[model samples]
Target: MLSFVVRRVVAAFGTLLLSSVLVFLAVQSLPGDVATQVLGKDATPTAVAALRDKLHLDQPAWERYLEWVKGALHGDFGTSLVNAKPVGGEVGQYLGNSALIAVVTVLFAVTGSLVLGIIAGLYRDRWPDHLISTVSLIGMSVPEFVVATVLVLLFSIAVPVLPAVVLYGPDASVGQLLPAVWLPAASLAIVMAAYIVRMARTSVIDVMAGEYVTTARLKGLSTWRVVTRHALPGALLPTLHVIALNVAWLVGGVAVVENVFNYPGIGKLMLSSVQNRDLPVIQAIALISAVVYVCCNLAADLGAMALNPKLRTRGGRTR
Candidate 1:
């Protein structure tokens, strides 16, 4: 188990290193000049050259990458060329707001998915199963933006219950944030739940058909106990992997949902930076997203190993 965890951590670090290289190269390849975006297009070549020199855009690619990596190791992501602000400080604020929304969405999604999935699996081929299946399909079919738009129209425009745009102040309380957060969170939750429900339902149904489940049932265990204890534990392992992937998506890929609701988040910030050709902010957010993805995947693998000891190995191979 110790060796397994060590291997996974090392691999995760390697993945992050590779991801940073790729993200840097990809961002550098984007059309348009950073200096031009920072200063207007009307700015003369001399002014653009001076700005590029100041921001180190004049440096060689290899030299700049090395400097950036060195600074990143020291928690210095460099200053934003456009805003002239510390990249770390600005990204930190955006990350906090994004995390708040993502966490709430995940909580709602996982809980709802688990319940709906278990019910659908237990009542396989019944109306309950059919209903859940249909809902899951619909959830998967609709795009998040459409869902966000409809939500705004129904709740914000028609009913006027929830706030249309998310504009949370620094001093805002949880209750104050909820109305602003609901539409975005719900948009994410609905889409995420589709995958979870399908995975959970399939896992539970398969587990119920296993010989161990039959033995438990034959031993006079009650229905709920047999399902909850004997089945749910095994069923949840696969569901957990799906949940981890969705968590990663929530972190980095909620751009459309966030934009639709005008929610201040890392995704929206990254998009804005892309448009403004702000390399520091864009690179910082990309690196953060990659790190989050690698870390979440590592956590998922660890959780799976803990839940199923049979997957652990004394040697290089699982027993």
Candidate 2:
């Protein structure tokens, strides 16, 4: 198990390194001049040139990438081109905001999806199964933007219970941010829930039909005991990976939902950085996102190994 974890971590770092190259190149290719953005439209070519020179934008991309990588290895992500703030500090602050919303979305989405899926699976062809399956299908079909809009309408306009968009500043405390977090979280949850529910339902069905579960039922075990003791544990293994994938997906979803709701998060910051051609900040966010993605999958793999004893052995095939 330790060797397996070590190998996965090593591979994850390799993934991060490769992703950093892609992120840097992608952001570098985005059309916009940070110097021009900093100086404004009225700035002369000479002024822009001087600013670019001062910012070392005239250097070769390879030189810049090497320098950035060197600094990143030591926890220095460089400064934001637009604001001259440390990319690490800026990202740390807003990353928390984004994480809060994503965490809230995932918690509720996972809980509700598991319950609905399990119930649906147990009921099989019954009305409960049909209703949940239908809702999940609709959810899977709808886009995140559509879901966000409907949530805004239902929660913000029709009910006027929650704020339409976050009004708090970027530096607001978590307590201050909570009231505004719900709408976006709900929007993301509604969209993310479908995949998890579908996966969970399938896993449950498969587990229920497995030898042990069938034997347990034949032994005259109560339905609750059969499900909870014999089926749920097995069912959860596949669903765990599905949940991890959804969590990784939250990064992209948060990007969209944050913009729609005007929430101050790393996603909103990244978009703004792109518009302003703030390469350092953009690269930093992208790297952080890649890290999050890699870590999610790694953690999922470890968790699966821990849950299933077979996966702990040397010959166990990794899923």
Please, what's the RMSD in Å of model 1? 1.8
lDDT per residue for candidate 1 within 224-278, as digits (tens), equals: 9998888998998998889889888886558888888877778888888878878
- Candidate 1 regions with alpha-carbon error over 4 angstroms: 168-176
Q: How much does candidate 2 score in TM-score?
A: 0.93
Cα lDDT listed for each candidate: 0.87, 0.88
> For residues 1-319, what per-residue lDDT tens digits would candidate 2 score against the true structure?
7788788889989999899999889877866787887799999999999988877789999998998899988879988877788888888899999988988998899999999999999999999999999999999999898899999999889999999888887898999899999999998898889998998899999999898998998999999999898788788899888888889898888888899999999889989987777778878888888988899988888888877887888744555
Each model's RMSD to truth, in Å? 1.8, 2.0
Q: Which candidate number has the best lDDT?
A: 2
User: How much is 171 displaced in model 1, in angstroms?
Assistant: 8.3
lDDT of 2: 0.88
Clashing pairs in 2: none
